[model samples]
Target: APDSGGGSSEDSFTEDSSTDVATEDASTLIPPPQLGLYGTLNQLQVDVSRLPRPDEYNPAMSSVEDFQTIDIPSDIKTVAYYLQAAQILPPGEDEIRFSRQEDQLAGGLVRRELDRSIARYAAESGDTATLTMTGEVLAPEVTSLEFYYFDGLAWVTQWDSEMLKGLPQAVRVVITIRPARSANRPEMIGLTNSMTAIEQGDLVYSLVVQLPLAEPPETMGDSAMEAMGL
Candidate 1:
């Protein structure tokens, strides 16, 4: 659909309003929207982001702390091709997708693109040169972000429609923001645990998104059919 803008982004994944998520329940909280997710390119700021075009799932989760590159499955069995620029855009045009760091070579350009993406986010929220450490600026104030998939059973750390043979029944994401560290008390911060973040005055937001469980469309590509063992 659309991509997150450098420096101007803030965990705009689907858009959430309240920054103080500690009071919000565990349910996936919906934001009011700032960046247009679909084809709302060219605008640095939007009061609310538009929804993705039906049949288009090029998803990205850019926000305050982490900026990952876009990952669109090539031979997916479930999702209908979720990537950008080369696939989503008209031939020869480039586009940004919401994402994070590491394994950036998504859709063949994940790592490099994500580096640039995170660089943009880090420049605004944090700093790209700094690792996930205390005092190291991540995106704005966001220090870490993570995504999970629920396949009607247990929660998983990662999800690939190609491997699962269908879309996830629900998705869970955790975004951690480092509250301004105290000048008098400087400490090291690592992006490995949410509880640790909470103990250190960091704000951790958890969102569980439930998706409709629909049968795959009848129009399956040969690769998708093969992956599904059709």
Candidate 2:
């Protein structure tokens, strides 16, 4: 790690060799994601234009400035940026190729955001959930990123959109983050997430995201909207 690289961070990530990765016995030697230092969270500045262009949406508005700065919570730990993808036309020629449309096949009306919970369900099945969850506490870059659904009744830690045929009115995203140990760490290693629950620092952050009503078009079938609880 660089001498100036030290902030609040965990140990330096290793450049894993093919031989080392292939050896099961050597895997335990590597430590899970851990917090390095504890300090105030710094403000973040974002460049609007430099961000990746979304699949949809028009660039109707022109930027007066290139970048914008914003203040963040000083006690915060980490941040995870996510994008939900949808396209009118998916890859390749449209028809005769097994219905490769995101809306028709995935059915945004019936399975909003492709039932993001399926991946979580798979991860949290049986004893495996123990492996993924940091359990009673959250650790920087170590705890499982959890989503809680606030159904009309109460907030639930889990949801199956496929089984329910739709999604909740709102969602609560909870997770922790660790700062990059080195400047190049992000490009080289990406954000490190633990496969197993880490018992270390307890740092968590949550934000409530109220979902827009998934209103179907007038021509859309009544069955789907009803299933969606709209």
lDDT of 2 at 35: 19
Candidate 2, residue 17: how far the Cα is off, in Å: 35
- Each model's Cα RMSD: 18.1, 20.9
| CA lDDT, every model vs. true structure | 0.33, 0.28
Any runs in candidate 2 off by more than 4 Å, and if so which? 1-142, 178-200, 214-230
lDDT of 2 by residue, 1-230 (tens): 11221223322221120111110111111111231111111111111122323421232331211101111122222221221112223356334422222333211101111112322333344323211111111122322233445555445544444444455555554343443446744321112222111222334344556556522244545553443233
Best by TM-score: 1
Model 2 clash pairs are: 8-37, 9-36, 9-37, 10-36, 78-177
Taking the candidates one at a time, how many backbone clashes does each contain? 24, 5
Q: Pick the candidate with the highest lDDT.
A: 1
Cα lDDT tens digits for candidate 1, 65-154: 332322232221111111111112236432232223333221211111122233234445543222121111213344444455544544
Give the runs in model 1 whose Cα sits over 4 Å from its true position.
1-139, 184-190, 213-230
lDDT for predicted candidate 1 compared with the true structure:
0.33
